[model samples]
Target: MAGTTWDIPSGATVKVSIIDSTMRLSNMPTTMLFDNAVEDFDHLDRIPTWCLLVESASGRKAVFDLGAPTDFDTYAPVYNKLMNEAGLRSGFKVEKDVAQVLQDHGVAPADVSSIIWRSEGLPVSVHSSHQHLDHIGNPNTFPKSTEIVVGQGFTKAYCPGYPTNPDSPVCETYFADRTLREINFEPGPAANPKIGGFRAHDFFGDGSFYLLDTPGHTTGHLSALARTTHGDIEDTFILMGGDVCHHGGELRPSPYQSLPDPLTASHYPVPAGLNITGCPGAALFGALQTSRGRRARDEPFVDPSKQLQEDYAASGRSIREAQVPDAMDNVFFVFAHDATLLGVVDVFPKGANEWRDKGWADTARWTFLKDFAPAAAKFGEEK
Candidate 1:
């Protein structure tokens, strides 16, 4: 058995909320719901910063995607005005962060045994998700004994840049959990599998939830997912996808943004600019270069595309990015920020107890994923 199978307990429940909802922070991340006044520009995804909490049969509770960067409210007037014009506002906090979230259900961050990030990226500032400061914003805020689960490659590939060793004081592996498989592979399996800090990972099996290597946006960037079955009639599902796509403009690939312009170099297709510095594609390209040199001949290196997420249309975040896991048919994509997702989904008002499984089930979000859980039963555990 890879791990525990899903046995929906009477006490076991998962809760999700939009944490941050501001557009005037640093640059409106591709995820935040910031509208674009410029006709030439794309619309914004003004989604609230959201943190997810899940309680297990063993009484263990965990949170996903802590909160966006703290400095989002301090933006200049021009940016704030633009965000306001586009219907953007801020409402993200930390103490009230997970504290309120937990208390609402009778819990606290201190009670949380672990805080597993969908991808470790800092709030509001750094553009990359693979780095420590990017993900483990203020480790002190978490419980003194709380464990941080950095995805396989995020743990390995990013250690070098940390102020200390990965196993040192700040960031350490929560478990021996590691792997190097392309999580997006169909049939739900792959090999050469040692956890790669450079690739993506799936924490436990049962494929209920896992990590994805969400490249293109950052060097060692990864995303998170949770497979859940909803509905009494058909037993549909909801998927919580963290940072796979920032906003509506990003869900779909855009001509790699003016393919040949230097000013737009940051947005070029992930595979095209392998020689650039500090880019994730460059890292894979560099790895290939090293491999070829050792072989004494030019060999076509490993393909980074294989490790990339297939689509951001909800299914884009799944294992094969094809069909929604069997347990779920409808999925709620918990993007940290995205105006469209925010516009479409209702944000629970403060002190209001009105909450239900109102996810992207009926909208385009539902059609985005495939139906796969029923077929995945045969994909069995492999060594």
Candidate 2:
């Protein structure tokens, strides 16, 4: 994780916007609400949404995750019920559909050369549980040439890191190629995208953006980062998040503390509630967030380590303590599911900022892999 690959274009600015794709399912519990005394929430699931646009340094446009299929409008009541429960209104009214959102933004699947999936396809709307339709709107509907990018271990589960957690309301029944193969139409390699250090393809390498294997959430829950050196990275827009944590909610104590109380037998997290067959401690140890960290302790619950173990194959290798390269400085991590301060990203409506506000910052950007082990050796909680 040391030595970031700065081969990407510099001085470019990459910005992101959270699009109102769809709200979370109804019947979310109370404990899960209010994620961020430091981050985002006041209850309700972090309605699985999509980040519409990313303008790279060269002004190239990239769409991170595509919104659900346009036909979802018919189920307006369910989604509306969800938003109403959250006590929040979407900034964009197009929640009815993303078709207009895409057209208004001038982005079509063909125009979008980069496609990074946070997880696999879920049939939730049509299927019960982590049904393929519940998530991953379906890419087969998109232009074939659009790159079908995904993390190394996307095949294991389509519920982002949900499958990894076990207790997740979503059932880890779907496979990547099994569920997602239907949506894929890319003409290029399905093998891993080239990323050495922070060195990524940029997809087009013009500074548009590329995916980084963040792992954890799933075996290879990847994060998309777009960099534009708006001045030095002292203030860069990074989105270091994923399903491992929702919004910034898991970062603090109040919301996280409430989690255990509501945990039930049916909805209890797989790892959190059950004892792993071979592992020694509690199964939930590695699955949920703790006062210490949201890791599955019994079997080295940090799913990211498994990704590293896979030789970075399926992002199942050992990325623990692997330092994020310096070249990633100007980048903003776009996977807001995890609560790492380095994750959640905030952005204004495209033209809102007098300045081109691309991402959010203020959280400490830990040093590279080279210094991490030693530094973390000294890093500790006051408790």
Candidate 3:
């Protein structure tokens, strides 16, 4: 976890924006998050596959995740089947593709210079946060000239994707003939000890963007940290937390911040009847008998160390510590699936670089806690 810190030059700025693919889907509770309960609520919950657009000061532009695809059938059969079983097979339509979203913002697929996974290519490359279908967003949809980037160990883990593997979730053509650069996080002796508990590589080499080695969700999952503002020594940053923590609640309520009561929380428009005046942290769902229900104290939970999906809870804890409240305006954690950000921050064409002024971090801080309102009301008082 040791790595050197890269310094951002003063006055250098990166234009950042949240691009809405407008792709939405209804999912069972435990599908997006591990320990949640769907049967406890009356209906299913939905979230958007939000993407990011980061443009460097020198005019180099790159896109983060591609969000969901308009023509999802183009993806591998294995992915299609999984989405089908997960109830996410049909909600996707073409109009919300990442290409369309970029065009709407006056940028075209041909104009982009790089495709950084999890985060860009030329006018340079297309990068994936990991190999997940939603994160990759049908990379073949991008211009063929654009290079594809991934985190360390990607090729060895999933190189001959799809068709070849039959059950592979990625398409083989995505990496075929493309400049697929896998990020090697091995830092030299001069590098610092660590960058937020993970190895990091200064992506631009100029200190503006850093590719972090945050594995857990998948074999090669990666996250990006961008310096939003330059200061004397330490600068402010926007942590593009790919799939590290799907929900805000998964990372909030650290030592630096606590859950906001109904009256103080401003981001979410609390309904007329539900009043969690003094709500504590996230509301916990009572024990149920579902296939993935919580195990009793006597029963053993899955050892995170051995899970093939990586250490989700450990990743959540790392992100939580990085975005603590007192950590100053220096850090803003943007998990890919945090629905609370839908209206809090402006979308593409309107950059989220103004997040500090807009108080977006504080606004959306405790909004996720509201999701448990109904469950809390039905159960006893907040714990």
Runs in model 3 deviating more than 4 A are 1-11, 36-44, 91-94, 119-132, 189-193, 231-234, 260-268, 272-308, 312-327, 379-383
lDDT string for model 3 (1-383, tens) is 11223333333568788888776655433433444433344333557767888888787887877776777787777666665664555544435778777887689887766666662210000132112456677677678777777877777766577788876666788878777888888878323224656777776656677777776666667787777876675566788887766665445444444333333335445445775554322223222111335332112111222222455665555455444422445577787777888778888888887687788887776676456455544454523
Model 1, span 146-262: residue lDDT tens: 666554344444443323442222333322243213233223254212222223333443334445554433333455444344345432223445555443322321111111112
Which 10 successive residues of model 3 have the least lDDT summed? 121-130
Task: Name the TM-score of candidate 2.
Answer: 0.47
Report lDDT per candidate: 0.36, 0.37, 0.60
The global Cα lDDT (0 to 1) of model 2 is: 0.37
Better of 1 and 2 by TM-score: 1
Models, CA RMSD each: 16.6, 13.7, 6.9
lDDT of 1: 0.36
Measured against the true structure, the TM-scores of the candidates, in listed sequence, are 0.48, 0.47, 0.79
Q: Which of the numbered candidates is closest to the native, going by highest lDDT?
A: 3
Tell me the tens digit of each residue's lDDT in model 2 across 1-383.
Answer: 22343343443455555554543444333233221121111233344554556655455555555545544432223343443454433322224344346556565545655455554332223212222222344454445555555655454433442346533323323233333321221235532244444223344444435555554434445555554335543434344343433332222112112222232332211233332332221223212334335432211212321211223342323132122332243444334332222123443234311222433332322111111121122221111
